[model samples]
Target: MADLTGKRIVVGMTGGVAAYKTAELVRRMMDEGATVDVVMTEAATKFITPVTMQALSGRPVFVDPWDPRVPNNMAHIDLSRGADAILVVPASTNFMARVAHGFADDLLATLCVARACPLLMVPAMNREMWGNPATQRNAAQLRADGIVLLGPVDGDQACGEVGSGRMMEPHDVLQELIAFFQPKPLQGVRVLITAGPTAEPIDPVRVLTNVSSGKMGYAIARAAREAGADVTLVSGPTALATPRGVLRIDAHSARDMMSAVMGETPRADVFIAVAAVADWRVAEASAQKIKKTAGEPPTLSFVQNPDILATVAALPGGPYCVGFAAETEHLDQHATEKRQRKGIPLLVGNLAQDALGADDTTLILYDDQGRHPLPRQSKLAAARELIAQVARRLPAGRVPTLAARPAPGSPSAVPSAPPSPLSLP
Candidate 1:
């Protein structure tokens, strides 16, 4: 899944038979953890009820420009006040013209004209209307104005004739939404990441593993991909879905994860070791499930597991290595020590109790320079910032052009303050 945990989106619906599809788009965005506000033109309400949209978005649907919902009767501006993006689904030919010509006759139109965020529109219309020279001219103008036009994908339309003008499927539009928000800072770079807790077998049915949910690692993979890196994720038994556009390899144990990472590290430009590998494994795992005997408990011998991060970092000319340290105490001390011990350029530290299996995280970056604290936020947001920080530290020739910073209204645009040392768990 593409992580949109803290993204704020405004789904602008225009009147079209495809207006029904906008409901699913809004639901999909919200499903990915984005907060969606549904804005509708009066003509749009004719196709889909405001009640249905409101129910899906969990916020009041805005349709009337003079709606009392706004303190100053400025629904047009207020609805998009802090939005990260404005997506117009089933953008009718009329709506396209209105937008291209800067018309603000309706609330939706007014919002488009007044929005400070990126405007993305998915067009839907009759085949002839889409082919009309006038509509083409309007589209050209929209493109010229920096308005992103997704598609009036060629296919069957609501009308009997089927040449072009079908709205992009809700899921496809959702993919575009994810792509639009992602900043491609690591483009042309290949990132190899290990995530989740590697399990070491005590027996066929029992194993030793940590509390890792793979959320942070998975979040990093998503962020890396969004940063335009070709990401390969080596996961250890995570229930989470594969992030879109990532190559995923599964690992069952520490040895398995090591093999996977070592195999991919040669081609990677960056390597992130986020998995919590078992520190020890049974010296000899039992082939059969160990049975408890009433007389005495079976004695199990243990041996040290391979140190994945240290091993990778020790490799000659290895990818820029980044390690993760989850400490319950002495976070800064341990994190800094680990970076030196592992011979890595960067090490990320967080409280194990605070981050394990959780959606939110507070991270501190430890390097030769000093400690840099990142504000507590969703793992996805933190991952993006982490990637940016890594990009900045990359050797000059290896670094790629990065996407611009998040716009002023985005949650990520919030200023960072030094986190209190006492806050570490």
Candidate 2:
């Protein structure tokens, strides 16, 4: 099933150049199985025609407050009555001021005022307008009134100037909408995760690394963030973009990963060791590039790397540890033994062939209760399920202190001091 299956959304557009993005948003929403109803203000219609929105939404666009389409002529009330949420895309500074004061002079504002569902606003305007003292006050008032604001992120704007007050990209907006509907089981929890494959340098010109693509770990990071955890990812080299609302630390080798993980683990409530760390490294890596010989290869000795999970688990009063075991065979035995060996409460296991570099895989959760296998599914879906399992297993009465946790984009939300930068071979 699609993520938003059976969900009903009301997409409200105000006057702004960002209205073009709303067209894509509506199409993407429908692609995710959400039934969308497009609502437009008079100013919005001037920017993007109602016919364009109607074509994208597959429903008759509503722009007039007194349209005869509604049986009772109350489009504002009827349109939003059954909606799960009303999302105002490209909400202009003027519209925000009107809504902030409860003015319902227009159809979209009237629907917002009459809506029973949650209201989410995406502010899009000039940096100066957004930074205006009055606009700031209005924003604060809207927040106080329980309206959710997605973003007016810093970036290039349409007015040939660059600063804050740009609408979030359509994909990002969709992600936020999806997260809004998710269960915040990890609210106020601090999660530390390691992802990708740790590289061991054989020489300046060569490195040994597994085929692990870090998809699962990144997915878990995103899921944890969506579940309201303050997530920090210690990632090895990977081309994937950092998940929204996640702090990322770069790690190249096993030692680099270990250092990063240890530094952040003290403040973490949960530590998920998901990186495919190399067990061994070159005993003595050559300072210069090793040249290829005519017949024989240069001999190299290896030494075992520090066991990151075991070390962290061994720490006194350390975070709750979770380990992953990618086994070529006998996953049940290897996974169970690994969990016991590491002294962690939970272990996730999967077949190496099924999981490495793959987007979908079967996962088995091994705990004191026994092994519970999750159906093969997308990494994100599996990650969400794993987070749910972890939530259930957490100590009772571990109530979320959401207010105490740093809010996203706040200075405190970032790592105060990052680990030393890794110099990759």
TM-scores for every candidate against the unseen true structure: 0.65, 0.93
Give residue 395's error in model 1 in angstroms. 1.6
RMSD of each: 9.2, 5.9
Task: Report the lDDT tens digits of candidate 2 across residue range 290-387.
Answer: 98889898999999999999999999978878899999999999999999999999999999998898889999999999999999999999999999
Deviating ranges (above 4 Å) for candidate 2: 397-425
The true-versus-predicted C-alpha distance at residue 203 of model 2, in Å, is 2.2
Q: Tell me the TM-score of model 2.
A: 0.93
lDDT of 1 by residue, 196-275 (tens): 99999999999988899999999899888777678899999989998766899999999999999989988888999999
Residue pairs in clash, model 1? none
Clashing pairs in 2: none
**Local error of candidate 1 at residue 245 (angstroms):** 2.7
Q: Identify the leading candidate in terms of lDDT.
A: 2
